[model samples]
Target chain A: MSEWSKNELGQYEYAGGKEDWEKVEQIASLCEKFVIDEEDELVSDEERSCYNCRFRRWTKSAFVCMRR
Target chain B: MKIFVGIDDSRRLDGGGAGEIVSLLTRTIDEKGWGKSAIPSRHRLYPHPDTGYRKHNTARSFSAEVKEQYMEELIDYACVMIKSNGTSDSNSGLAIAVPERMDNTDELIDYAYRTKETMINSDEALAMAKKPGLYIFELSGNGKGIIGALAAVGLRMTGNDGQFRGKLQLGTGEGYIATVKEIIEKSHIEQVKNMDFENLGTEESVRMGEKVKVVLLDHQYTLMVFPTDRQHPRWQTSTTNMLRIF
Candidate 1:
């Protein structure tokens, strides 16, 4: 699994690359609020994965998980 | 005649999403007998560093086969829908164009590609939308969305760029796995191919994957698949991450 880091705003950001399908699924498996985002935003093949989560906000480099 | 409808910046952080609004608008067009609309494609725009977009910097666009007589009504309805749905804080814009009447598609395409690489001003977008059959209108706020709105249509017309706004249902089966022929019969996707662009044979079975989406490639809704280590399901649907380069 990839390590999760925090931005200046304290939002949790995934350390793995955008296409890290395995790591994304591992994260989503532990979170109950993993809501699938719009099709355009989804990077992982797992439907319920955190990479597909609605609360995640995309940035230039990586995405930040908005769920508290 | 085909009418390309594009919309951007039509929602606030607490409000409805731009994609849902655009989907509703397309559904209304069909219900009102305005046209037979296809699925909307979501195009990404340049993200602002200072003022963040609630979601990603993405716009929605689609094409409809409508009669020429109802063209004016269509535009009017779209503008009203966008304005009414968006909050006072929204900086929304709507762009509509008839490809048959557009003479400067190459210029529009160039501008559309540039928007992805750098920031584009609304003035330049408005200038491009001033052609005979092209229409660009500001729905609310400062109307900077006109740039992304117009660019969405331009990218769509390129026969490449953007992903279909939603997932495709391949019917219930053993999880997400299905034969290439079965997928073709069940969905509107034009074809299925591997990452290398080689078309998958009809008899071949592949995993549809969760949240399956097709990208607009070569003017077709193509479901791109990638090879897997397992031989049973030799191919799997390409994820949005894989298709993001488009």
Candidate 2:
């Protein structure tokens, strides 16, 4: 969560690469707004992980969390 | 005849994804006896800036075999589905292509790849479809979805891109550890291979992890596994993070 930075788009982009499954899960566990995305967009098996959250839009190097 | 169906831009901020909608469409095709379809393949497009795309720009597509008479019926059904299901804020489009009718497939595939790098509009996509005698339809909203829908058919025809949506159940239940042979025999998965692209023997067993998904390789639904640790079931199903490269 500390690694997240707010982009000009106002979304919180994960500082970690797109594959940071553990970090995504750790952060998602502490947040109450995690909503799992559709199966095609999911990258983590941990259902509640940020990597699987619909609000997390993917970028070339990482992803941005759209939910505040 | 083999027909390819592609759909995109069906989700809005309210809630929905093109992949989920495509899966439901495929199921309906099967239930109605329209045709048997392969697993839906997700083809990603260029994430054009300010295009109103939610996350990444990706489209869902699948190939179905049906009688020549049912071709029009199938396309009509897909159009109706997209119109009824697409989110109000999104510009949904559907494309149906019969590759055999296309005079030049290389151009289509090249266009599909180009979409990954640049911004393309409906006019360009429409021109390409007209030249190939391909079918493209705008289901709702701004009609920009035609770009992804047409590109999806092209990329799928190439047989070299896209990750299959959802997991391929390797065992009777989720997370069931089973041998490679058992997995192949019991499920639709044709082969099991390691992450390094090495084939695992039939006797080798791997744990079906929570996300037991596959990618389209050599036109096969391949379940790729990786060695996570030195244990009895030394291998585990590859995660979406690993499969994302495809």
Candidate 3:
């Protein structure tokens, strides 16, 4: 597995300097943390923050962060 | 035969107010005569009934119902068209759009399951889809439209075990490049493993600002990207940037 650098918020950025990869991981993590594996089905701050992030945008049905 | 399109009111709103996008799409279809061969019908379901008490309480229920009806109509129309045409031709398609604000991902999953149930159990719709030439074009929205459609059609997210994933297909052109650049710049991030334009689809990984064409294929669906070099100033903000045929 490749190593990644985490920012102040515990968000991970890719070591190769690929921002889209970082964005994709951030989004995937957010989905895992807030949208998936929960009965309540609420969008948490981490997920919402991802939505507001530059690498990502919220879709009508899903949160679309960049993927490479 | 019929074609159905999902309309989300919020995204249609702008400085001029809501309904502009819908009007534009309707006009384009009308002018182009795309759906003229088969009758086109629309059903508008609000998040809340116009004259209901305590709109907040009924919002979820109302949205669910609207989505349910929309999916049912698409299935119904596809079945009719297939039976009449005797094949799963290009004409048998459904186009859908959703609002950006309705981002409850679980609700979308639920909606997909329900759609699957209806399709599996209905004799009429199922029989018509014997060949199952169904195409779903998810217009740009909050990304939920495509995600929901992908889930409804059973595309699981790979590598994450149970997690679901949806992919966006962009055409090779300046517009697509601009879109990628905006996504990267807005995302506040950097590099990707591969950058070759021709090898994009085959590459194991892609970068933030690469140009490529995407095709989605399955037994029942085919999504194709046709590149147009002309750029629209509003394409970035417009939800109609992408087209889905199902």
Candidate 3, residues B20-45, lDDT tens digits: the string is: 33334444444544433111111111
List each candidate's DockQ score.
0.35, 0.46, 0.01
**What is the fnat of candidate 3?**
0.00
Q: Local error of candidate 2 at B164, Å?
A: 2.5
The TM-scores, one per candidate, come to 0.83, 0.86, 0.20
Judged by TM-score relative to the true structure, which candidate is superior, 1 or 3?
1
**What is the per-residue lDDT of model 2 for residues A1-68, given as tens digits with 9 covering 90 to 100?**
57877766676667897667787789999988888777877666678898777776666557777677
lDDT agreement of model 3 with the native: 0.26
Candidate numbers, best lDDT first, in rank order: 2, 1, 3
User: What CAPRI grade goes to candidate 2?
Assistant: acceptable
TM, chain A, every candidate: 0.79, 0.84, 0.25
Instruction: Assess each prediction's global lDDT (C-alpha) against the native.
Output: 0.78, 0.79, 0.26
Q: What does the lDDT read for residue B138 in candidate 2?
A: 85
User: How do the residues B71-116 of candidate 2 rate in per-residue lDDT, one tens digit apiece?
Assistant: 7787888888888876676688898888778787788889888987
Stretches off by above 4 angstroms in model 2 are A1-23, B52-56, B172-175, B228-234
Please identify model 3 stretches exceeding 4 Å from their true place.
A1-68, B10-18, B37-133, B138-142, B147-246
Off by over 4 Å in 1: A1-36, A45-57, A63-68, B50-55, B173-177
Best by TM-score: 2
In order, the interface RMSDs are 2.8, 2.7, 15.5
